[model samples]
Target chain A: MHIDAIQTPAVLIDMDRAEANLAMAQDLANDLGLGLRPHVKTHKLPGLARRQVALGAVGVTCQKLGEAEAMADGGLADIFLPYNILGAAKLDRLAALHGRVRLSVTADSAETVAGYAARFGPEAPLTVLVECDTGMGRCGVQSPEAALSLARQIDAAEGLHFGGLMTYPPLGHGPETNDWLTRAKALLEDAGLASEVISTGGTPDLLRAGQIPVATEYRPGTYVYSDRMQVAWGHGTLQDCAMTVLATVVSRPTPDRAVLDAGSKALAADTCGAPGFGHLPAYPDAVVTGLSEEHGVVDLSACTRKPEIGERLRIVPNHACVVSNLFDRVHLMRGDEVEEIAQVTSRGALT
Target chain B: MHIDAIQTPAVLIDMDRAEANLAMAQDLANDLGLGLRPHVKTHKLPGLARRQVALGAVGVTCQKLGEAEAMADGGLADIFLPYNILGAAKLDRLAALHGRVRLSVTADSAETVAGYAARFGPEAPLTVLVECDTGMGRCGVQSPEAALSLARQIDAAEGLHFGGLMTYPPLGHGPETNDWLTRAKALLEDAGLASEVISTGGTPDLLRAGQIPVATEYRPGTYVYSDRMQVAWGHGTLQDCAMTVLATVVSRPTPDRAVLDAGSKALAADTCGAPGFGHLPAYPDAVVTGLSEEHGVVDLSACTRKPEIGERLRIVPNHACVVSNLFDRVHLMRGDEVEEIAQVTSRGALT
Candidate 1:
């Protein structure tokens, strides 16, 4: 179905903009000679991931064990589970995935490393990357000595191989990125080991990706689908936004207020205290004051161009990543036509 | 699958509590000699509605046109659409629904009444009810005269029937409800119309439902699946809550903070300014400090216990109605075992 004919409150991806975004990232990586391992958590659709892979993406990175499983099932040859997979259930799934795909995952503890080693022997080896805390206090080993020791222990595991050192840096370009990687490489060499792939990430530092030394790869997912929040953070322009939510004004309760069919169920509440619910294409200054399950509370006072009842409008959500998880299907639209139906393969695969 | 065996971030419905909640509401209506038409929007699952129907519920009420259509598809004989059906799409669906089952819908304006009349003729009548604005200035006609005029327009239409008048007042126990309904009923009689039903609804005021004079029916959906918010509102206790989101702490980023697998995708963003993402049944004081799409940020500093990364948690979300719309399927749990799975009909069905 076309954009106008399809039901309201459906996710619409502009394929032309998406292709432009893909080409922009691939071109940047080509110029810098960096391996592009795009994070698939931002857009869980296998069709979009396949387009990225076709555009010379080296591999796809997963945020969870469940996401990795879906990726493998979607015929993804290279997979990277960036989170620490804890519990017997998750480790077993990881082990099975490793046997099926060229898989690698990160870890920061001996307890977790030993658990993986015991589950899968050296013959059915899984690549282990020691996650370093390069400033984002969310995960990984704190110091170089601690990280080196953990890497040594992980490398010595019968079933695991020390693939590399990776750090998901804080959302900015900092000196810690250089100091930590330099210190980490020295410590690994001192222990007679190699940090084969020194990977660093974060969209805030993506533009300055080439500045980080000894980095073999860069992974940025949201750069391909710029959102209002991303634009506010100076990541991309409104012109770069590829995905938008197509909604209709279902309820015109008042002259100043109109409610759209798209809500938290379709938009996915991943707001960082933004101005509007989604960036209104026709009225950019409108604020989404409130949201019900199937209703988007829009405050059109800023724009003063009130949308009439049954009026169709396009909205770019605050965060594109969260919106992908809310829908099982998204229309890949080009101009007036729907090019294809992209299934969000691992959307809500939060095991 | 049992609670422990099922994957994390799954929707769970305690059948015992659900049945108890239903029984309490049924008994309340029976003792008061009132007709109970439970709203299906809270727990879109038909199995729950079936149980309520078996418990002597008169019919079911739906908020949107799509929900009423879904209830009709599930073999529900009577349904009420309590919102204004504005658009041609919704109008067409409302007309289509009249062919399948006995349907009643509310309209606050003459424009809306004319639209409904144009769709369904007298053979398949679109029963129109005047929505009264008793307290909240969200929707509905302002005064009894406006309601009377709207009712007259519906009664005079070729394909419409002036069913009655409906009012969803703010949760309270007072004489204002009696005054509003009394004035509304007098005006309806003056317009030469006999209102068949005076449908009133409010879970908070269900106990005081008898205060309204000559009201024939009441709609209370949340009573069938009590939530933590309902308990906080003094409607029920924590022991009465039937629905919960079972999630696991996937990340323990800090000593005081951990992240659960359930986020906006499962719990939704329908706080209405509640305390946290949800209440932790096992740990009462622990609060969900923040929420991302797939990460429910929890702070355990004030609580007596700490959550392990893999430990399962049962979260009673702030609003039960919005939570049901998030999941496509809900597992019916008895004690520790899962009895069956009920598909969430009308999930993403935004007409």
Candidate 2:
């Protein structure tokens, strides 16, 4: 099968580009002497995760247990889920997963750690990372004091091992964020508690991971498939992008407007600081001005030669991770030739 | 199975509310004396489509050939795809579906009609509707002249039947929209061209669907599961919403911040005119301030009672259609009791 033979509105992964990206990211981590634990949440394909591990990643990081489960089924051994696991149902699943793989998770509060404690016992201990809020106000404990409190709680728990500290820092706040993590590690040392790992991640800050100094391991998801947002953030150029949504021009209603088969359902509605939903390689100036569920409305006003009906184009979405979740299977491409088809093993694994 | 036993971050459909909403929409269409053709892109469940058809819909409207195929497999005889059918791959699928069911589609240009004419023949004629731009600046022909031209092309085509006209009008543009459709129909009549159907749709304007006297059919998808946007648009109240994302509060990082297990992956990031991502039923005062792939951060500063870790809450998302597409199966609930689980058979059918 050739790349052009594959249906439109399908995810096309440039295998050569992805291999280069994986090697580049791994080499960057190796040069920095930081443990590379590439997040599998970006591609969600076990085949890609295996490639990442083969390229010298210590393990794979998963945001959801279902993703870890998929990876484990695909023969992955070590997994780190840096999200709070709550409820008896989820905890039971977590406990079962801990028995299967070398698993660790993160918690920002005593309540979450307690939930983890109730599930895993001393016989099957689970490593727990204390998520700290360096600057990203999304998740994690607010301050160094709160981090210590959570770390102490994890240490005291019977079935849990206090793995280390983790933070998804705000971009460009590396120095101060490192200072904050350093203070928390110092406080842990003062209390005679050992911090095993210091994890930090963000594709935008993957190159600067070594600058933090305190972070022993780095988890970067989007680095495998740099997207429009990555280019917009100056992480990499558009040529570095591996995954593209293969779409066909479904309608050319006017000289200024051309509609594509890939819409919000295919490309996703995530506009992570991009001017539009996605960037078209064939028509660089055409803006993806609007998207309904199944229609991506492209504004071809700026383009001198507008796309016609049935003209296939590749779109690099704003956020690659979200776009991967929107599809079930992705076409692996080597140049214009089709390499293989890979299942998005953890596409809807949101449990 | 009870509702609480179901895992977190699942799509839950309130059966009673859904039934009520379905009946209300059907009754409204009946009262309006307009043909009801509910769009199946909202739920993408065969059971729900069957229910909608049983309620009095002339047929089902689909946005994708994949969706229409799913509906056809579910025993739906009449399926109208109001999206421009482009490319030979999609045309082959459309033609195969036409042989099995009474399939109709929309075309906004001559190229799309030509594709249809090449795939299908008079024996297996496909009903083609000229998609007109009723002021929604999306995928539609810009003017009444354009609509007439497209309709004339469909009529001239050997394999296609000029079905009628269709428009996804801008909300509340009934008078002028009717004037435009009426003028186009009059031109078709003057040219001895017959338009058997004139369809218009928008959940926000479903109540005023009859106001457009030229429209012979009304297609509304979100009415079955009205969302936060529906409430914001004054189409319905919060209680009328049938679909709710059952999410568990996984993290309470601060007194004011609580993170739910559902994020953009579950609730989706498609905020359709709502202030935040969704509406929390348990804590109406709380705001869904942030969303990552697997984490929905809530702001509880305005609330007196903060959500604790492990507490499950129901969130009504801003848009129901996109949320439904995010999940694999939707749990049917009967007043806090799990009734059944319906597969989203057409969820990712975006071809």
Candidate 3:
């Protein structure tokens, strides 16, 4: 099938561009001598996860247990969930998943660690990594001492093994993140805790993974489908973006305005500190000014040529990860030909 | 099932509140002597749409044909899709849907009218409303004259009927919108084109529907499930909100910081000119500072009390309509008791 054969307001993944992106990220990890565990949250497809594993990835990282379960169901053996798992329901699910595959999780607080310790037994231990707040300040232990405390707590738990550390560092703060992780690793080492896996992630600073020498693994989610956000941060160019929203011009209401069928529902409401909602590669000067639920209003005044009614245009969204989560399936295209239509297996896995 | 038994990061629709919201809107429309056409884009549930119809709503409004198709499959007889339907694939779907239900659509351009004219036949004529731009400036004919011109074009078409005029008017511009629609209706009358239905819609100015006396039908999507946006626009109070995201406090990294499992994927990244992504009734002063894919970072310094790890929080999202589209299933609740878990049939019906 050709690209035009598909419906409007659809997510199209350029297969060639996606494969090249995967290969480039894998080569970077190999050159940096770091284990590459691509986060499946970007694609949320089992086939894409398998492709990453086949490309020499150590494992796959899932932000939610539902996503991890989806990956495991797709035959992914080694999976790491770098999230604080709480509550009896999720813990029960975690125990079941651990029984199926090699599982690892992270914790920033003792409350989360206690829940994990209660679920698993020493006979079947679960690797628990202490999440360190290097500089992101989202979800992690406050300081190096706090990281040591969590490591000690994980070591003391009967069913838990103290796996090194994990951090989703702030963008462009490579040196600061590296320093923080180094000090935390040294503190853990001084306390006789061997840091086995120091996993760090951020797509913007993915190429600078070598700066964090202490990080044994690099997990980059958006690098597989670089978006306008990655391009804005100088990670890659528009050509590197594999995913684009295929939308049709439903109404050219004004001479300067053209509305597409894609809106916040299709493109998402995420802004990467950019000027507009999305970038139209065909009309680079045209700005997607605003988005309703099902209408993307484009300001075509800046362009020399404006799209007419019924014209199809592909839009590069600001964020790739969130956009993937919005759709149920994606059309994988090889240039202009449709390769496959894959279900986003973990699309609404928000448990 | 009890609300406590359910997992966190879930969409909970308070059935009592939802029913009350539905009744209030219907009563208001009845009192104002206008045909109520509730937009199902808010709830996206067939059962809820049925409730709206049972409460004397003339029909349900949909923004996309996919939504109308889902509603039709769910046994909804009347649906008004106020969007420009283009392309052969969509027109084919629209024609099929028209065969099943009482369908009416809007078009702003002759190109769209031509597409409809090619598909439909006079034996089963399709109702095509001239979409007028009443200052919203999104997808509609610019002037009242343009609306009449489009109406004349629809009248001339072999398979289409110029049923009426439709406008998604600009918020808080009731007088200007009324003037635009009134002039357009007069133009249609002067041209011997009878506008059977003068439809106008906006959740913020729904109460002022009576102000547009020329409008025979009123469509309001968000009034069925009032959100923070509606509250910000002074449409309803926080207590009037029906849909909320039940999220868990997964990490309380600092005394002033609390991270939730519900982020953009669960709560959405839409802001209604408000300060934060959501409003936590439990902690009114707390602000949701930022959101990652699965992490909602909350700043709790302003609150007198803070949420601990594993504590569940019911958050009213910024926009209810988009939030409902994010989840696959919603737990309908009646004061802490789970009533039912219904599938959002049109959750990803973006086409």
Instruction: Write candidate 2's Cα lDDT for B1-351 as tens digits.
Output: 888798878999998998998898899888888899999888998888898999899999988888999989999998989988777777888888988888889988888888888888887678999999888887788888888888888898888899999999998899989999999999899888888999999899988787798999999999999999888887989999999999988878778998898989898888767678999888999999889989998999999988888888899998899888888889999988888888887665567
Interface RMSD of each: 3.0, 1.3, 0.8
Candidate 1 Cα deviation (angstroms), residue A192: 3.1
lDDT of 1 by residue, A1-351 (tens): 677777777788888898988898889888888888998878887777877899999999887777888888888889888766767887878878887899988876666677778887867788899888787655677788888998998888888899888888876654668788889999899888898888877665677787786788888878778788888777777888888988877656566677777777778665654675677878877888766556687887777567876688898888888777767778899897998877787654566
TM-score (chain B) for candidate 2 is 0.98
Maximum-lDDT candidate: 3
Error of 1 at B112 (Å): 3.4
Off by over 4 Å in 1: A133-137, A208-214, B86-90, B109-111, B135-137, B170-181, B202-215, B269-274
User: If you superpose only chain B onto the true chain B, what TM-score does each candidate give?
Assistant: 0.96, 0.98, 0.99
**Candidate 3 per-residue lDDT over residues B61-123, each given as its tens digit:** 999888999999999999999998988888899989999999999999999999999999999
- Each model's lDDT comes to 0.79, 0.88, 0.92
Q: All models, DockQ values?
A: 0.38, 0.73, 0.86
Cα error, residue B71 of model 1, in Å, equals: 2.9
Q: For model 2, name the residue pairs that clash.
A: none
